[model samples]
Target: MKKILLNLVHPDINQSVVNKRLLDGIKDLENITINNLYQKYPDFKIDAKVEQKLLEENDIILFQFPMYWFSSPALLKEWFDVVLEAGFAYGGSYKLADKSFAVAVSCGGSKEAFSETGKEKKIVEEFLYPFEITANYVKMNYRKPYITYDAEAGLSEETLNLYVKEYVKYIKEL
Candidate 1:
């Protein structure tokens, strides 16, 4: 099986229902390295070299987080700025080419909110264009994102359980 790198980056996990449950479900899985970014770098000071090393060691990279204001938290953005440096992740002497990247995210709004008939009236894919562009820049295969909607409203126990199972399946398949 291919090694998978699961990068969990939630700024406020204590208040996150969907993400916390998802993490709890897969915390003990094998052949998967779960890097809790906030826990590892509470001071907001990331180790670029170590992060780069981790990126190089894994075959599939998963960025797991709750969608905040249509994007990721500040630290995750910082991680990209610092770790995915020039001549490494993109630009001259790029190294991330041919790698795989995917996003596992949860949104507070329902799926309808991301469609023409809903509030935002725009697809989530359109909102996540930047991530797709980044993956393209690094020449990585950007897989379809795995999303859980209306997370704040709370899901049925059965539905939540299914979400966890599907999440694991998504990561494994990638």
Candidate 2:
């Protein structure tokens, strides 16, 4: 079985529906670590060594978060700065090479809003290039992100359940 570090980075997961359910749906899965960043480091003091060690031990690194201002939550970026250092994630003797990297991001707008005829005038993939670049930089395999559009007001209980199942499947397959 593949070991996944499902790093969650939501400002307030209690107020979240999609991200929280997504996390809960996978609790019983074997070899999956649910690392809630905000809960762990509310004061923004990241333990780089421990985070790096988690990365080293996992077969896949899955970033789960709500898209914030076209990027990840602050702590995820902060975690990146602190943990993905030389001789570990990149630079000489990098360690993340060949592992699978993926993201499950929730967007506030509907799918149409990101379409060419929609408000943003761009696809969801456009906002995820940074993750792709980071994955590529570390020589890890980058997969297409699993996006949940209109996350705040979107989906019924049935739809959310389906999405959660899909998310679980996505991680297991990776």
Candidate 3:
């Protein structure tokens, strides 16, 4: 099994419903390393070298977080900005190629809201284009994202439980 680097980012996970549950379900799984960014870097100071080292050690990198607005939380973007700098992730002599890069995001809105007739009226993938592009640019294999709709105040207990199982299964498969 490939070593999975589960990079989790939640500004306030104590209040998260689905995301927290997802974490609880998979926290003990084998061959998986969980990195909770907010807990590690409360001051938003990302250690680029350490992060790069983690990236180097892991085969499948999973960026798990709740969708903020239409993109990831601020620190996640910051992680990219700092850790994926020249000579390590991209540009000269650097290509994090062949690595599996994917997102496991929680969306408070329902699936319909990402459809043509809904509120955003744009597919969820559209919002995730940046991640895909980044993966491609680094020559990594970008997998389809994992999403849980209505994650905030909507998903029922049964549905949340099902999603937790699904999430664990998905990560294990990867």
Candidate 4:
């Protein structure tokens, strides 16, 4: 079976209600490697070589995080900056080329709040453009994001369960 890497990059998981539940639902499945970035790099010191090795091994990569200030947590950004080196993830060499990348994110606000027709003044797709651009640069297939909205309010067990099922389905398809 092909390997899928799920990088959980939540900074404050202790305070996280949504992401914690989602991750708990799938932490034990076979063929999936869940790398909790914050726990691994507590001092923000990411091992570039190790990250590169993980990327090389996995056929599909999922960046799972809680949306903070419309972006990834500080540590994930640092990981990208340090690990996605020139002549590796990008440039001509393109180590991640032909691999699949997807973002599974939880937003504190409601779905309506992330729309031009609503308060936040941008679509969820627009908010996720940075990830898409990065995936494009690395020549990876940028799958549509799996987003859970109103995350701060906490999800009902039914809703969380549904999302977890969908998440597993999404990974299987990739």
Name the top TM-score candidate: 3
Which of 2 and 4 is ahead in lDDT?
Answer: 2
lDDT of 1 by residue, 34-137 (tens): 99999999898999999989998988889999889999888899999999998788778667788889899998899999898899988888888899999998
The candidate, 1 or 2, that scores higher on lDDT is 2
Candidate topping lDDT:
3
Query: What is the overall TM-score of model 4 with all chains considered together?
Result: 0.95
- Listed in order, each prediction's TM-score against the native is 0.95, 0.96, 0.97, 0.95
- Sorting all predicted structures by lDDT, with the top scorer first, yields 3, 2, 4, 1
Runs in model 2 with CA error above 4 Å?
none
Clash numbers, per candidate: 0, 0, 0, 0
Full-model lDDT, candidate 4? 0.89
Question: In model 3, where is the ten-residue run with the lowest total lDDT?
Answer: 88-97
List clashing residue pairs in candidate 3.
none
lDDT of 4 by residue, 80-158 (tens): 9999999888877998999999999998899899988888899777888999999999899999888888887767888
The local lDDT score (0 to 100) that residue 80 gets in candidate 4 is 92
Candidates ranked by TM-score = 3, 2, 1, 4
Model 2 per-residue lDDT tens digits across residues 31-78: 999899999999999999999999999988999999999889999989
Which has the higher TM-score value, candidate number 1 or candidate number 3?
A: 3
lDDT of 3 by residue, 90-163 (tens): 87855578999999999989999998899999988999999999999888999999899998566788999999
- Which pairs of residues collide in candidate 2? none
Q: Clashing residue pairs, candidate 4?
A: none
